[model samples]
Target: MSTPRHTLAQLCAAVTAAPVLLVAPAAVAAPQAPPPSTVIGGERLGLPGVQVDPLAGAPALPTDLTGESWIVSDATSGDVLASYNPHARLPPASTLKILFADTVLPKFDRNAVHRVADEEIQNIGAGSSLVGIKENLDYRVEDLWRGVFLSSGNDAVHVLSHMNGGIQPTVDEMQSKADALQARDTTVVSPDGYDRDGQLSSAYDLSLFARSGLRNADFRMYCATREAMFPGAVDKNTGQRSSFGIANTDRLLGKYPGLIGVKNGTTTNAGSTFVGAAERDGRTLLVTVMHPASYQRVYDETAELLDWGFASAGKVRPVGRLVEEKQAGGEQPSGQAGGTAGAPPPHPAGAPAGPVAGSAGDDGLGPVGWSAVLVGALVGAGAVVVLRRRTANRAGRLWK
Candidate 1:
């Protein structure tokens, strides 16, 4: 019997040609500096030494989509199923509220009441969305969240930011939360996601924020809610109390089967950006689409991606692993990538072990690259092969 043989050069060439899924180590060191660019290029998207199966028999990716960047992944497993320009930084519009909710929702008591101040609602740009918050009106924290989620109200976001501390401090904390989540592509200059200089996030980062926020019961309920009767404000002069209804901006909810709450945004610069999640047969899938040409296109493209992902779940192989959250104290377990939980067991000598590649350096070719190829024999034999590699060079590591 002939033994299967694979060489470093052969594996390197193959990995360089296609996307490779990576399992992240348990711990990672704190970054010394931010990445030079926010865009996650194709070269850095894949993990070296890992080979994924091609989506040969699955539904084809959407072609007529107008979004500038998009991504679909398994919500539970954090597996990136498909993406296009996943890391291209662009205006996020109101979807940035997901991050805001993640950062501040836990800080305040849901039943706590805060009186709206004129200064807290000041500086909301003209033509921005609002929930009709009035000065001197006391509102429960839960009601404010409903306003923010149901109406995409900038007013609610500003008021909440003020409660947390101030607008600037809330923005800084949100940015820090993004960094801790390993969502390096996000830069938060506005809590409400209104257009501002240097306020941007990528499809990948938006998806990350949504997934993280979903862990909170309040965030999930707010986004999933279709309609709610908001708290009534008492008329300062007339002494009359009035309440109004608000509907979720996310069109996918109730419209798409198995669709749950997420969020949506639109603006002159951002066009339409949406994050959607759906569950089927115990599996949940999340999709993020940004900068669609039209409001309807965001939903359409997201639905298409979700349909493809559900159908392709077991059939299609992963091109890249979603980077996991860095553990506390800045210590990562050695020899594993983002998705892998713990240190990997050592392999025997001369085994078919593949080396994991680090980020690219000055040279165009880094220590490793990944590719997907049809392995007829392996597929026919019902065998999946994982190539493991380890290198000493850590400079410019892909996941900082």
Candidate 2:
């Protein structure tokens, strides 16, 4: 697709119109109620269009940033470093998988095994990315997660959704989980994030999803895994299952300094979307870039924002903060990530020891040769509560 003729001019106009602020950033909250609507964090954040609060000595913010929307924030402090149309709703592509992972990762012990069935894989959307999942194959819970994190496989996502129940159930749960996180800009019409009429998410909401998902250790490990050996079909002659390698789709996983795991997505409808995390000197930053005009620029713009965020760290005041999980419009942990009291242990008997080597096939950038491949969330008492109870009841049958 050709670049839009007026994108640069519009962006420059947005920057020139933004205000310059020098006030110290502060944390604000009203635990007794849902998030305030004025500005979401402060008045500075509410202004229409792109909002960039400049620091006196800090070098200019990236001039070449391109995307429909984007955000950079400090994971620990929740300070929104910078944004442009952060709340604009757009197709999330596979980046929405972060929320899917956050909602489902804590429910099952990684060792739990499930055999894929025909119905489970029957309904995946066409032309979507896939990790080669086939019917009647038995896979550990951890294996399915790797397909998701690495290959961005819709097939793997459908299998996992069936394990949780079914597609509509998982979609409902995802929507409720998004609501609980105050990510109101999202609509969960499809669990695998394949484009649908009503499905959408904003850069702000996607960041919240990534921040929450990163709190879980399993979620963290899977996203950071650059490569892994995925189970292959059983040899009919010997009845022994073989394995093939898969690599994480996230481009920055190894090339970028301090870059941690996250996710990325691309589709004709959504363009390109990505949410990435990195740790530098004990400080972690989260960046989300959605619908960049080109596949490569999505990554380039993200890296640029991250660079600006790190360099401008102490110099700029935060425009907003990522809201905490809430209940009845108040602070609570019932559905919190990595903290659900009744959730299964992070690791059980069959947990993965470590990731494997990179492969020649799909790495989320482009496909190479070779075969092999394949492809969550909650509701009620917040989604986690319902999942916790269900997981407890289903534990006995999990590995059968």
Candidate 3:
């Protein structure tokens, strides 16, 4: 079945207090950012400046680090190695596309085709990036995804957003997806991630989005790809098609060793933002940098963070975890990002295991399940006594 479609403006209209709200963000300077987020990941994460456990001989944190918000975490264990203003809400620019992809990527087959409509491309914000999507041109779902990952194309995003039923519903679903990931700091106002009055995300939330998105095979493939061909306008007379090349906007895609493609974003209000993932020695590290000192620093600082995170190894203790519990849907993690295929989650360090713990009659809910069973057993005993007394009375005999 095909999804119904709605215009991108409809989403903001559904959420926005007034149409006048949109006019000011673009015409004037970005307003002063709101207060820092109330720290969702851990106790130490809420503190300002750099955060790292003091471990003997650990590599020093990058001295030049200047992002307003950032986090580095182990993708498998979900442990946050370190952070700086991790919960600070700021404009995400295109990095929010990661969440958009997380919400909408699984809905359609890659080979499915759609012809662009005049309305689909309507209302992409001013100064928005483009991959040259033209009305009346047909594109495969795979190519559209490439446009999103590689070119950071707003046009491509809108078309897909429409195909998913409409802009309003897509935004709603994206918000729902964010909540599902426990990304408490995100507010989705625009699906293409263009700057808007209420649209925002945190470094922590962005990292979560990247880690969750990495679990999908297709998402991994698209983000890792450096280049792909996009369809050109059809020649009306010849009835032929030509293709144009599009390369990934991420600067570290080819330069950084062991780096996996994630995402990059820049906008007037957001400055520069990025979320990067890399795998080394069966461990994957996720890094997110938002509102760096300059356009270049976002990538440079990200590389430094990645280098420090890899080298820290046993030297630094984890401050907290990205998610404390799994919700069991939409790219559910297999516990370890690099676990042996289908291996169960590793037991907590020093926690009891083996036959003894199992013999305690654990239903995985631990003491809570046992408590319920104990209450049930006592209630059953009482019911048996009451039934015996009632039968004796009815038969004209009594015994206790």
Model 2 deviation from the true structure expressed as Cα RMSD, one decimal place: 26.1
**Which regions of candidate 2 deviate over 4 angstroms?**
1-39, 328-400
Clashing residue pairs for model 2: 131-373, 131-374, 131-375, 132-373, 132-374, 133-374, 153-375, 156-375, 378-383, 379-383
Rank by lDDT (best first):
3, 2, 1
Q: Which stretches of candidate 1 lie over 4 Å from their true place?
A: 1-56, 235-240, 332-336, 339-400
Backbone clashes, each candidate:
20, 10, 4
Q: Each candidate: RMSD to true structure?
A: 15.3, 26.1, 23.1
lDDT of 2 by residue, 1-400 (tens): 2333445456445434642310111221111211223334444444445666777887578888779888889998888888877877899989888888977788888999998989888877889888898898899999999999999999988888888888889899998898788776789998888999989998888998999988898989999999999999999999999999999888989988899879999988999999989999888999999988799999999888888888886888777777777677545655332122222222222432222133211121111111111000111113323333333334322223
* Number of clashes found in candidate 2: 10
- Give the C-alpha miss distance for residue 158 in model 1, angstroms: 0.6
Better candidate number, 2 or 3, judged by lDDT: 3
Q: Per-residue lDDT tens digits of candidate 3, residues 1-400?
A: 2322545455434335543432222322211222222345665666667778959999889888889988999998888999988878899999999999999999999999999999999999999999999998889999999999999999999999999999999999999888777777789999989999989899988998998899999999999999888899888899899899999999999899988989999999999999999988888999999999999999999999999999998899998678732356644456522111122322333433232343222222234433443332334434323433333243221111
Question: How does residue 167 of candidate 3 score in lDDT?
Answer: 95
